[model samples]
Target: MQIEMKNIHKRFGANNVLTGVDFELLPGEVHALMGENGAGKSTLMNILTGLHQHDEGVIKINGEERSFSSPKQAEEGGIAFIHQELNIWPDMTVLENLFIGRERRNAFGLLKTKEMKELAREQFEKLSVLIPLEKEAGLCSVGQQQMIEIAKALMTNAEVIIMDEPTAALTEREISTLFEVIRSLSKQGVSIVYISHRMEEIFTICDRITVMRDGKTVDTKRIKETNFNEVVRKMVGRELEDRFPARNPSPGETVLEVRDFTRKGAFENISFSVKEGEIVGISGLMGAGRTEVMRAIFGLDSIDRGELYIHDQKTVIHTPNEAVRKGIGFITEDRKDEGLILDFSIRENIALPSVKSFAPKGLIDEKNEQQFVDMLIKRLTIKTESAETSAKNLSGGNQQKVVLAKWIGIGPKVLILDEPTRGVDVGAKREIYSLMNELTDRGMAIIMVSSELPEVLGMSDRILVFHEGKISGELTKEEATQEKIMTFAAGGQ
Candidate 1:
């Protein structure tokens, strides 16, 4: 299979998202599409998938010019898109979710359940996924659900598979399994268009790389010929001195303490403490209970056995509202579903956490809210047309900044961030790390849950390793190495 897009041009009202962009993919190759946020990567992909029409462009597959009117047309033509956001039917079983809208039926309209199950099992085996076929998709963890999305793409018999940040929600082991699956598929003559902000993954798995800037193609290079620094330079059009900002630790009294927290089968006896002016990182594999523990601390989950102390005072937090009132903020891992409302405007979303302040007398002070949002937009460097722009209209990085702005407005004493930088670009990741430093400098305690070992090591003053719903070990800034953390994360004694 050979796919070529030439001189692609697309515009949304006054925004020219893609202008004179060119892209190509060959058979049996993993082509990486690299760019900073809002560099028109998603816009170009949307044009190819028929979700949006390009003002001017040409698409050719296998030497035949093609114009798809809908996503179904593109799918039927052997193109499948695995979106960055999980798009599975949560209530349906894995098998049913995979075969939705494309189920095989007999002449009498009876579904071929057994045949579909067998096919699903085969794909799962190929991907090394161990999830139960009959299990509800929502019951699975984020990493497991990512595997299901991949399997669903494979079920389409797609020759050209487009994976948009497929590993964003996966752990190290699940990522390895996905890379193996990609290699196997490539060897079978399946061309893959991989889009990711993670530079290491691109270097490890992709054969060729295309860098886009603004609304145009910057350069394309063979992975072996180009290095990470050069690729990043092209993507952001500048030199990045360091991925993580310099950390200055000035510890204060403990602000939040969890003693022997337990959540039945999810996690047990998880104990930790976060001090003022400290950035504590939680490191672990997927399903290792990092997120579960944080949820319990943030009052999103019930704690069966434990004690929570805030400012040296025992406190009872039975709900998120209570947590918020007790000076706690939680930025969930799945930002699309939990962090922000998609249909809401940027100003509205930013004001959500502190709505009471804007409406003290039962009526919203529109002027005050707009001024606050404008300040956040400028301070966070959020790129948007105006405060009224929909959260769904902004780039992934900008949307993350909005989530941060909302929390910052609340002035929480303890902030819990789950996968804080997932799916964001390199520039934005640096900005977020800097923001963490600033927050901690102001005596705000932060507990970060990250699967990226480098991030944990770079930004954390202390690290807590989790394995199989337990605290395996703890390390200080000077003591925590990637190998040491991994050893503990793998359930080492």
Candidate 2:
């Protein structure tokens, strides 16, 4: 399969997202689409997949000029899209999701569950994907769900697969497996459109790279001919000397502390402290209770036994509001789901945390609210048309900035960030890191829970490794290494 998109142009009102962008995908090759957030990667892919109609473009598939009216049309044309967010019905079993809308039936119209399960198993085996066909899709791990999505695409006999950030939520082991699957598929003459912000993956797996910036296709090069710095320069239109900002100031007195925190079946004996002007990173494996401990501290989950102290004073927090009032803010992992209301305007979401401040005597001060949101937008460098724009309309990085703005508006003394840079572009990641540095310089304490080891090591003043619901070890900035962190995360002494 070969896909050629030439001179693609798309516009949303006055914002032209894709301006004459050209792309090509060759059979038996993994072609990477590289760009920063809102650089028109999604828009171009959406146009290719028929989710959005391009204002002007020429699409050729297999040497035939094609126009697709809907996603089903694109699928029927042998193009399948596996979005970053897996499109799986949580209540449905793997077998059911695999054969949806194309279920096999007997002459009496009875569903052929046995046949479907058998076929699903074959697909999984071919990809070396280990997942139970009987298990509910929602209950599966993120890595498993990603594999199921691929299996489902295989069921469609797709010749071209478009994967958007497929490895974002996967473990290193799972990522290795996925790369193997991609190689196998390429060997079988399948074309892949691999999109991601992780530069390492692009260099490791992609055969060719297309860089887009400001809605234009900058250049496409063979993977071997390009280096990381060149690709990043093309994507962001600037040279970023460092991926993380340097933290220089010494940490102040302890601002937040947890003593012997225990959550039955989730985490136990978790003890850590964050000093004013310090970044204390929590590192661990997926089920190692890093997130659970933070949730407990934020009062989002009940703690079976523990003690929390704010500014060295014992505190009791029964809910998120209580925690917030006590100067604690939590920026959750999934910004779209838990952090922000997508339908709400940026102004509304930013003002949600500080509603009381903007509203005196049960009435909103429109003037003050607008001023606050505008200041955050400018301060955070959020890219949006206006404060009236819906939160969902912003790019991934901008939406994250909005979440940060919300918490910042609350004037919290202690901020807990979970996967702060997850799914954000490298440029935005640097900006967020710089913002963290600025906040810490101003005497704010940040506790970051991150799966990215490089981020943990680069930005943290100290790291606390978690293993099996307990604190495995702690390392200072001068001592922390990826090997040591992994050792502690795996429960090694």
Candidate 3:
């Protein structure tokens, strides 16, 4: 089962997104597709998966030329893709989600419930995925939900599996389990098209690599023949000196304090504080309640016990609106789900938080609005056509900037950023790190929840390790190290 794209050419009016892109995947081999954001990775996958039509190209699968009019057709032809944005339904159970499109039914038209659940459970067990099949999919941890999505892909017995950024939210242990599954898939002769932003995963698993840049194929070579720096350069057209910027200023007096905060099962007994001009980095295993603590402080989740104080003054924030009014801002991890409205323009998305402040008696000040958003766009180096371009048109990194700009426009005293650079490119991540330094210099106390351990150590003045719904350890800048945090976190759990 070999898949080949011969001289693919796709365009939209004046924008030639993909130009003569060519690649091939051999059976039983894991191949990684590496590229920066808006570099035609998603577009090419869409064409291969039948979501988009190629203007000009020929696809050959198993030595036969074929065309896919729809995703169903592609599935019938033995192609399946797990997109970067998850395609699972939150309301459905694990078994239901797996057998959704291909539900088995009897002659009398009754669905085979027991058979499906048994099959689903077998697949999960084979993949070393632990998930409660009867529970609602939304209630599961993000790592567990990702495994369920993988099980759905396997339901098709797909010969060629395309996974995009599969481990973005997974912890070290979960990723190890997923790699085991990938090895099993390869042993079963399943060809894998793995797309990842993390360089570490590619080096660990991929047998070969295809690098894309500016909508064209740059190079394809054996994994051992190239290095990480070389791969990154091929993807972005330049060398990246640093991934995380330096945080210099020492933490001042405590600006925001949470004393013995408890939020039931979501998170509990979290006591921490962020000082002025300091970044307090939170690290943990997946579902270890790092984000929950941040959410509780921002009033997204209510606390049942303990006290929150701002600058030594006790304050109770009941809602997000109150948190905002009290000069606090939160950047959610799921940007598309919670941070920005995709259909709206960049200006509207950026102005959403502060529109009331600038609006005089229910009348929006367009001039003032334009002036404010335009400055942010320029300052953040947001790439867009005016401020009126739809947020959907921007790249992933730019969309993240829109979310940051939304909160930054309000000039909040305490800024909390969750997975701030999840899908951003290398250059964008550096820019974001620089922006964090600027904000801290202006006396903002920042609490950042991040999955990338290097980022936590690189940007934080102090580090807090969350194991399982509790604080496991706290370290100042000098004492925080990868070995220390990992040992504490794994044991604390």
Identify the candidate with maximal lDDT.
Answer: 1
Q: What are the per-residue Cα lDDT tens digits for candidate 3 across 1-493?
A: 8989988989877788899999899999999998878788888988998888999989988888976888888888888888767777789887787888799999999998888888988988877777878888877767777888888888898998999888887788878988998998999999999998788889999999999988899999999999988987888788887777766786688889999998787777788888889999998888888888888888888888989999899999988999999899999988877899999999999999999978878999899999999999998889776799899887777899999999999999899999998877666777899999999999898999999888899899889998888888998889989999897788542
Model 3, CA-based lDDT: 0.87
Tell me model 1's lDDT, rounded to 2 decimals. 0.91
* Error in Å for residue 189 of model 1: 1.2
Per-residue C-alpha lDDT of model 1 across residues 188-269, encoded as one tens digit per residue: 9999999999988999999999999998999988999999889888988899988889998898999999999998888998
What lDDT does the true structure give each of the candidates? 0.91, 0.89, 0.87
Better of 2 and 3 by lDDT: 2
TM-score of each: 0.98, 0.96, 0.96
Q: Which sections of candidate 3 miss by over 4 Å?
A: none
TM-score: which is higher, 1 or 3?
1
Clashing pairs in 1: none
Residue 228 of model 2, lDDT score: 88
- Clash count of each predicted structure: 0, 0, 0
Candidate 3 worst ten-residue window by lDDT: 242-251
Off by over 4 Å in 1: none
Encode model 2's per-residue lDDT on 356-453: one tens digit a residue: 99777899999999999999999988998899999988888789999999999988999999989877898989989999999999999999999889
